[model samples]
Target chain A: MPDLNQAGLTITPGTWLYRLPWIGLGIGLAGMAGSAVLAQGHLQEFLHAWLVAFLFFLSIALGGLFFVLVLFATKAGWGVSIRRLAENAMATLPIFALLFLPIAWGAGQLFSWWEGPGEDALLALKEPYLNAGFFLARAAAYFIVWSAIALWFASRSARQDDSGQHSITRRLQAASGPCLILYAFTVTFASIDWIMALDPHWYSTMFGVYFFSGCLVGIFAFLVLVMGILQEAGYVGQVIHKGHYHNLGMLLYAFMVFWAYIAFSQYFLIWYANIPEETIWYLHRMHGTWSNLSLILAVGHFGVPFFFLMSRVIKEKPRLLMAGAAWMLLMHLADIYWLVMPNVYAHGPHFGILDVAALAAVGGVFMGAFGWALRRRALIPVKDPRLPESLQLDHA
Target chain B: MAFLSPQLPSTEEYGVLGEFDSPRSLYRACSQVRDAGYSRWDAHTPFPIHGLERAMGLRDSRLAWLVLALGLGGAASAMVLQWWISVHAYPLVISGKPFYSWQAFEPETFEIGILGGALGAVFGMMAFNKLPMWYHPLFASKRFQRVTDDGFFISIEAWDPKFDVEGCQKFLREIGATHVEVVLR
Candidate 1:
């Protein structure tokens, strides 16, 4: 029998975990800022765009943590070994909740739809969903829902180790259906608030799916990167079998396809309709400095990832698979940069120091918070009733 | 008289020469013997037998894993190559678009990943199964020639410790075998 009481996995901060990645951030920020300044474009707007990027990447870390909880709650056997690494990131939600204060502070500078001193015609028009008060309230509500679901499921699984009953598994499964639905709704509105509102006049019915696919892709990438770190350190020795890697690889493969589908659906839908409000969104992105960024995203996000992830062999190899996963994470960062930067840098695409520093600053803080959450308990839900099923999963 | 002394292994002692059988009963008997755990025997159908892998208790193929790895490698290579070309190498300013527009790269990235995965699967399947095996050892038997036509057969090799030329002939005859053949390797 597996041991009931076990110490959780520990990822000490010495792996550059605590120290802020200032070097990369500085370089990135400098590149972005220098480009904007030299071009004599809108400096203030460019910096604010970088700030939004920091928030966007933070969402990746937060969303990953949520995925970790969902897998645990469902006793999802396929992702067991990788689930712990995901949990490492999920534990950072409360930190992100606090970090969102900056967006609240710079409301007018970032979102043109937010209420300003004047009548704010656009803000008034979107009063139902785009107002500052409703925005922060929804933000809080999203956290509340996500945190409750994650905490309840995580605690139940951990408690099962001592209880050794099937109830914990049953309970989590019962909650997963509703939790998944809630996750979908919450993410949809969250995307609407964070990125979509950047261009309030523009709308796509498929925008939610576009954001969701990237989130899941980011989730897969983040999980792989974290697991790679753990494996490199020798944590999951035998429990993470070849079959498990094969499955994780396949899921990543599946998501690569999914992300592509949603992305295309959004583009195809908007382009096919060709309305002024919608067409102009593509117009800004497809011309001038933005056009090249759009094309790069086209090939980088879909073309390369789609083809490479399609193979079965690449998904199975740990080193090869992780390399792809890391590449995807970088792609996601670039993807968000493309989505966010065009708003600020009307002159061109900026890839400078502030963009880099802001991301590092947020990442360091989020990691610090996530580490604290992991320290509270064991990495895996030792008491989960489905633990055995996951421990020796047989496949055809 | 031979009962008192140990007998020698020979095709003549096995009784009659090999004979071909129709595919239906041959497959049925092969399956029954397989179910009985006769590891030394092999089925010889005119064409590839469907569900034979499972019937033989073969383990799942590693081909899927190979395909997955190849797909991942392809995606990685595509991204880096795209990045290198756009950012470091060529860095072309096409149509006023950024040299590193990720949106445009998605379709190509997808293609590369898929191509790698496909190549991996085909190659992996061949490598894992040790394919390109132009021949099987059983082809040496004269009776085995019918396996290419409208015939199905079973040959329990002489190497099996339980195989006895006389005893096996009697066993086959009692089991309603149309013809029992002793094959020379």
Candidate 2:
């Protein structure tokens, strides 16, 4: 009943996130320096990696908000106990909304369509959807809708937890069901608008699902990493048992397979079609420096995890699970860069200072927001009627 | 009723229906009552009671019926939508394919149907269970973890025509229950 800070050593008066904005600034500066010093040809490549990493982080923060809604809508007890963790993830949404500025600022450098191809040829082709006005409008809409939902859900949940009003719980559940459906449709179209449309020449109906797979996997990885950090800090130790980890790991494993399947299917479908227009995207990726990154991703992202996560015991073991989760996190970065960087640079793969610094910048921002949200709330919904059931949950 | 029950009801609050422990014992009791032709009897557990549907004289879930009905509707809509989109909307010829290739369009339709069926099943199950429930009387109990993980329970409602609290409790205990606590109605 006392404030979380007064609950003693479990929660402190202040969160570690207050220090993160400056850290983010430092990383951004370092990344800017690296881009300046990098090879002239590789400059665009470095910029692409930096921007892509920023977008990738932004996408997770956006999708993380959606995850909270779905769990709430389903009245999913197992996840509800740990819903605070995800709420913290969603709290980063506003920062991401602010981030679209830099994206728009450097759009010409990032997306090819912004650059000169022809007076009307490229512009006319992308006219239906790719004009700057429409692009900015849709991006704004997405940000507005997403931020409103995230803030609403977080406030309602936090408020209801204190109020002990049963109707509040029901309202969230009801809202969640529809909210999840809305999330699925919006997220799908948003993916189409943002990443899929980047390569206007190529099209895959499944691209939305592909992005969804990666986002889902990325969220699971985030959950694993956050849970590990929280456990080290001595919270939710009993409430989040081995069973929750196993289920989270299982989701990670499943989504990883899904990502692989979708990635391959897109490739196989395009390859089978063998069209000049469609094949060019793969042609650009599978040759030159991009080829090695693709191969590395194929083997490392899918193959290595497939072998290690196949063992159920490893998923259940916290340390081993963290290893798997951490691997997925690294891959998520690689995957996004793979999608974006090749479009910018056709040269050899380079993990320039910018790439690493950009990652740190975004990651610091993410951690800072995440930590602040968590410290304000209970680690688990201790008053939840189903808390005991979740604590006792065991997986076969 | 610890974890499952946020608040436990007092003994005199609800007409103390009847109760049973392990699922098998509950199932046997239900079957016996069902065979003896008791009409208003139901089993309650922490989760979906395996095989208890049969003992409780329930036929296949009504959800399956809802799914079938929805699947048929979805197929019909899918056909109409595809007709409108591919045939009427753009009608652009590509790869020498027909404008109205029903077979080519069938995969998406069939998928929509199955998806609709799944939706039907979920909603039907929830409706039948009267779920999306925020709170329940059982949530009051602090010892109710076994409902989900390892425990099973069955309650015969006080509303049942044949309901008698003491008699039902005696019958439940006679059916080899480990413990029989009256489920607060």
Q: Rate the local accuracy (lDDT) of all candidates.
A: 0.66, 0.71
Task: Give the distance in Å from residue A359's predicted Cα in candidate 1 to where it truly belongs.
Answer: 0.6
Q: Mind giving the per-residue lDDT tens digits that candidate 1 earns over B129-167?
A: 466566544555666677778666666656456667776
Model 2 chain A weakest 10-residue run by lDDT? A1-10
lDDT per residue for candidate 2 within A108-191, as digits (tens), equals: 766667644456575567776776677778878777777788888888877866676767777877788777776777678777
Report the poorest 10 consecutive residues by lDDT, candidate 1 chain B.
Answer: B11-20
lDDT of 2: 0.71
At residue A377, give the lDDT of candidate 1. 56
Judging by lDDT against the true structure, name the best candidate.
2
Every model's DockQ: 0.06, 0.03
What is the docking quality class of candidate 2?
incorrect
Clash statistics: count for each candidate: 78, 18
